[model samples]
Target: MSAGQSSGRYEAVIVGAGFGGIGAAIQLKRMGYENFVVLDREDDLGGTWHVNHYPGLAVDVPTTTYSYFFEPNPNWSRLFSTGTEIKQYAAHVADKYDVRRHMRFNTSVEGAQWDEDAKLWRVALAGGETITTRYLITATGFLSQPHTPDIPGIGDFAGRIIHTADWDDDYDPTGRRIAVIGTGATAVQLIPELAKTAAELTVYQRTPIWVVPKIDFRISERVKRLFRRVPLTQRLVRLITDALYEFFVYVGLHHRQLVYRRLNIAASDLAKIHRFLSVRDPELRRKLTPDYDFGCKRPTFSNDYYRVFTKPHVHLQTSGIEHIEADAIVANDGTRTPIDTLVLATGFDLWEANFPAIEVIGRNGRNLGKWWRDTRFQAYQGMTIPEFPNYLSLASPFAFLGLNFFNTMEYQMRHMDRLFGELKRRGATTFEVTEEANKRYRDRMSELGARSVWAVGNCAGSRSYYFDPTGEATLLRPMSTRAALKEASRFPLTDYQFS
Candidate 1:
């Protein structure tokens, strides 16, 4: 170990160096928090953006709006940013703000215990190091954990199996027969990209998803140069584009007529695409048809996924995989698809299920896992847990998910900065959101969510991560940015008696 590595404790400890973690660190630092440490298991930051580097893994959100409002990128080379580009942008932002000095890379946290006696948190790392802090911030996002399907005989399969989150850097899939399981956003983006290199590709599907065209293109050097030369152009573009997408989210999240029409327009456009695109029989087209209302499942955009099925080299397996036998996958229809590679685009763990693995003991010896379990894994504002005192979550329970993740993270971090400053000023050892304050916020938000397209929409047979296993649609926030701001504005810190 280097001499004087500084085992000194900080005022706060943040887990995961994703968008939320880095943004929170910056906010805290801006608020004059020099003692806090941002700990990440990965050698680098970027959260999901860092790990999932599979082929064609990119942000579907437009480049203009999919970043921090505080730190806009004028040099986005394309309409939709690729995973690598996003990572580069994140690294740039971190460097520009001098936030890397506060980060501890490759230091996985085992668990944290809230030291009630000292009014501090004792952080346990994978190594023998332990650090204590008065506060904890969890920015480990919704997509941090990969969900691998627990198929029997999966381990026995001779072929290489890779989760989208854990793509092998050295492994190449060129000219190999590959089987891709699941058809979410990840699947749609990856399948098309893999088609170029793979000799043959078979996409397994249990349920079909709704995908529209992604109007993506590379911005010319002249445009980017112009943007850099005139900063207002980027600002103006960002403002206009941000407002445009926010409307789509607004209707989808809130109960506005515009969202309904947009949903209809979405369905009509997709249904029309399938009508001309599917050269296969009517049964195949119908099987490919989605049962749920548009926007029920996370909406995807792909210009090539449907077109890839038209490829003679690529085949779409409409039937579900029954089991893995020897070196092949046997489907429910008694057909076997042989492949040398298996890729799971099976999405993430948004159920807040990873809480138990990391012990976060809060007030009165209460663990976060137990509290979440006892309370049905719900968060008050999708931020603070009752017994956790000064600790806050990034994704929380139900904050809206978006590519503009850093924007939300910075916003929440700033809010937290205000609260922490208040705590310091009052010289209070225990400062928590009153239980009444928490419940009231949730109740009102639930009412607002019910009116939106997310809850009471015409969804039928679509199964998605957006809906929990029970089919209750409560994951993403149903409120728009304007609505969220209003809701956030309602919950002033002074409403809760901090002591």
Candidate 2:
């Protein structure tokens, strides 16, 4: 019953104590199932929030709709909560649901193999410990692992080098010359914060991102009191926010020209803000504009990202990076710029097969990595795979909903709850997705993705992580949130084979 005590076998073992793992534990406990353990590598929960401690990290989605549907928090300080507040919310949920007692922190899964004779999963952990379980749920999210590009002579950098994901708490950048590479989501939030302190800040942008204005403000105490008094008011607000975000799905994934025209007009307004209000220089304004259509890649929301460029000490460089030296960066045009500190914001490895970051051996010694590489990534409803019995992947291919990830996690958890309930009803010990069913789902996904903007848009040069190397958009579901919720709620169990 204690943490990390491996004397007896478990009914289920959920990996990575993020929102997904905690949500799964809470759901299982609520269903009167308690023989499970949640394992996390870190000493605490909040997978991404526990790791990323950057200067100005915040969620882009509104806090009103970013929480679990069952348990809503009426005490959000801002419209978009900061990273620290989000992590605190995760902790609060874990404690409130009594899920923290079942968590084994500082325990990492090295590999997982299916034992054919025992019909159980043999999960190897760090420190040479092993645990056996009837079911394995992987909650290791897509954004947990940080991806750093291989630049020439990167190791030869003489100053402090940091990636946005692995920021150092002791290192201070005040009055220091800082160079930031890759202007992605993390960079857009942290750059403005860094610009306030750094003596001279230089940003190396590979491609322009479409950043709209962020309408963030504090929720007053009176509003919070009203939300606490009448919970339905908050619920209605969340519903409206969710509906507005789903409208973006229609504009981005489906080529709705009318909605696109309206979005273009909004984008034109943003362009005026950029050219007239933010930057006065002509060349700088041109470099800031994106050539591709909106939603080709992930759209960012920020109010000060463009305004930071107008500062006298800040510089934006769009030239290709050639290499790195001891204390400077070399551009493709042979221009050398000196820097005291380096920061790499080069996003995560979302599309690769090496994501689970561990060896997973399925039936017939089939490696999950090799199988994905050979046949491409395919999953049945983004939860179960073809050959991996008694295994479920949270937020896998076609599982991510762009509106908000918390909704996606809740949907997957609900689907898994049904699967487990069905298994209990049928008295089955194992389950695997049928190959035919997985293929049909994958074909449908490909067909829908082909018409999505990420597949056919002019975002090839944007270095977006939306698509894989084979030009397939494997990240997002090309359906509305309501449609995805309905499907997850009542999918047929005939697609799975149980024993």
Candidate 3:
């Protein structure tokens, strides 16, 4: 259908139905802005929680801290809730706030181009449908796209090969030789569970991850009842958890020397101690040990990850992959290991920045992807770019707090509300961050990135998704969540051009 014939123009078009999108929708509704629609590529509302259904899939962060401040759930069964619970939480929030009505599921946005003359955005859809909007909010998260490495004979494999993101629940691995590639966050959680069922499990490790103890436990019925009865009790717990997580950010990303260094040292010592105690053989311990600093890459929390290595049926392969044979994976040393199932836990593609899964053309018909590629991926607080007027992106480069995404979404949605409120108050048709303002923010991020562990030290050798193709740390914001919220709250609207 034609751009004007498909659907009437909307005030705002949210390009996701994930946590960020739902949060944005709720905020818009609260702000008395109902002329918005959230379009999702998937048939369901939940984003990460909807797609990932691998075995042993659970949140690393505590349930209290990982949830939205405005919409807290008092019925969490565990400290670290499973993926299903998180998905249910997302659905609950969506239903409670009446966000589902405004959502168009199974509708993928192909591309978006700014109409300079009309002062509107023309959005193309996958099914030759189009829609127009005054404001475009790209809420597509970083973890939406899965990345599987292109190994030789990958397509020629006789056995079933599945990515963690696309796991089949019916495909039982019992009595099957399974080879799991990439030992990231997903691998750490799934390995322990897979070890219990698989006849033989081989973990292909490219790099060792720093795994700390996961202090997870079931929330007693009494505690749940208390939380439900006394809301302040739960709020206090969330506050404490937030503070602890913020401290982690301060030490790991910001300070890194004074108290942070000491904490890191202590953590490193504990990890070493844990490794020493967990792995019986010294060689195996050494192989499992991470040479880089604790916070160089994303730190995982798992009590059973190391314990699984002691199993007789489980094997850790440190040898680099040469290629994937028809029915086996060939090692760099010419050793071939046969496997029935190949599970790739390689994680998502974070560097692509391909939100909306489309080419976004802004002012002067300049492509957003090309502009980002040429000038390095950047945005004003990872929200607005210079040329992309009336465009705001959530879960973009330099926006992530590296801790709780729910907190980030809350802060970002608040910031958006303020921006939209100001636009309405000023009777502005469009708004965009000034080049000077964007440059200053970009410079500050670069300065902070230089001091981060991902940019220096042993992290140089660590193959982390935090760094983009240009070798710049563009994924995470090197700032505390509180600091980020304060900055977003207090940033001058004068830095933005309202027209």
Candidate 4:
């Protein structure tokens, strides 16, 4: 159906078709509410999976822990499933839960504003259409917008330029000389693949990333059958994986100064060891080794990422790209290398173009992005804002829990159920979090954040995306996943104003 032709009110409107939006829709259905719509600008349902199909794309987190806690996929091809499998899983879940019927593909939302008189939200779409709904939920994932770096003479480059997020399917790099910029997680997965084919591969690195060995293996049919026959077995595996992930992220990363600073040191040493075994050259290994502490920026898992650098044809250029000539990139120290193709592995724009991902105006002309920037980026429990009544931002600051996004989605689903249950019980049309409650939660998070590695560790040169413009590491919440779930379910009802 054409989205622009449909203009009407809904009980609720969900502004994403990703896993978060699917989970929220499931929660709403479980609450016996069906009058809603899921909207995505893309033509497909899976958000990142649909947008990103670059070579060697797979989940960094283990597949056992990355799935929804309530719904487990018994037949995973690998321990770390490919992007295609994740997208299939998303479609399966949406179909099984019957939420696909309520989704509108190829729909772009421009902005949303609160209607004070009607106590509803007026959502503006790209094609001059308005959708009014009692509740507005923005599940636009954190990494929604692709960020193209503003390097000098980028537009004048005569070589073919490709961003990993928007990979060209027909383009072949078998015999071409290629240059890749930005060595983030995506590059870790892709560089090895490019090295196998490219005649000459150059990687321009600004900061070295900590890459650990991935213990990924194909799942046997016997194990798959066992998981299918006994769902409890899968649940137990998920529990164990979740525990290990939580421990590494919570204790190893966040509590580096307190108990077991050796854990972080050991992890760093392991990465160094991994690099030493792969790249025998002392200078190359030194250039690959990170100077900052581990977990300042998120670490990736890959066995081949380091080994790829050892190849004769592959060159690691530490002198950053100065500018792009028509067919080559010049280094800052006046070294220029010609290339036929340029690949940008630069990641998403999290703060500026993302966060809200669109313009959002609340009661009394309060803009969400402007407010967050002028003051500080804070969300009450990472879901609700003080002035945004009946609004839920799924990817807000302090919302992402653990390394696995499924953990975040699970707790947020619970939060949604509990919050909406109160609204139904009170017969309220609108609900907004109290300013006092928001402040208290923000203060508590700030206190916890002080002990994190990003705060106390050496991160000046890290250039981590975790740090916002205020120089605060406000992306991941400082608390453990268990605490986040507990708080989500048991937060005081008085924290919100129901009317």
Best by lDDT: 4
Report residue 440 deviation for candidate 4 (angstroms): 0.4
What TM-score quantifies how close candidate 2 is to the native fold?
Answer: 0.96
- Tens digit per residue, CA lDDT, model 4, 1-499: 2234445888889999999999999998999877888999999999998899999999999899989988999989999999999999999999999888889999999999999999999999999989899999999998999999999999999989999989998989999999999999999999999999999999999999999999999999999999999999999998999899888998897885646489888998899889989999999999998889888988999999999988999999998878999999999989889999999999999998987899999999999999999899999999999899999999998888757899899889999989999999998878999999999999999998898898998888888889898899888888888998998899999999999
lDDT of 2 at 291: 78
Give the Cα lDDT of each candidate: 0.76, 0.84, 0.86, 0.91
lDDT of 3 by residue, 203-243 (tens): 99999998888899999999999999999999999999989
Q: After superposition, how far is residue 439 of candidate 4 from its true place, in Å?
A: 0.4
Evaluate model 3: give its TM-score. 0.97
Clashing residue pairs in all predictions, respectively, total 1, 0, 0, 0
lDDT of 1 by residue, 251-333 (tens): 54456376576766675576557545753656656666777667667777777777777778888787677898767888888
Better of 1 and 2 by lDDT: 2
Model 3: residue 440 alpha-carbon error in angstroms: 0.9
* Candidate with more favorable, higher TM-score: 1 or 4: 4
Give the best candidate by TM-score. Answer: 4
Pairs with backbone N, CA or C atoms under 3 Å apart (clashes), candidate 4:
none
**How do all models score by TM-score?**
0.93, 0.96, 0.97, 0.98
**Candidate 1 local accuracy as lDDT?**
0.76
Q: For residues 126-228, could you state the per-residue lDDT of candidate 2 as single tens digits?
A: 8998989988989888787788888898888899889988999888889989999989889999999999989989999988888888899999999999999
Output the better candidate (1/3) by TM-score.
3
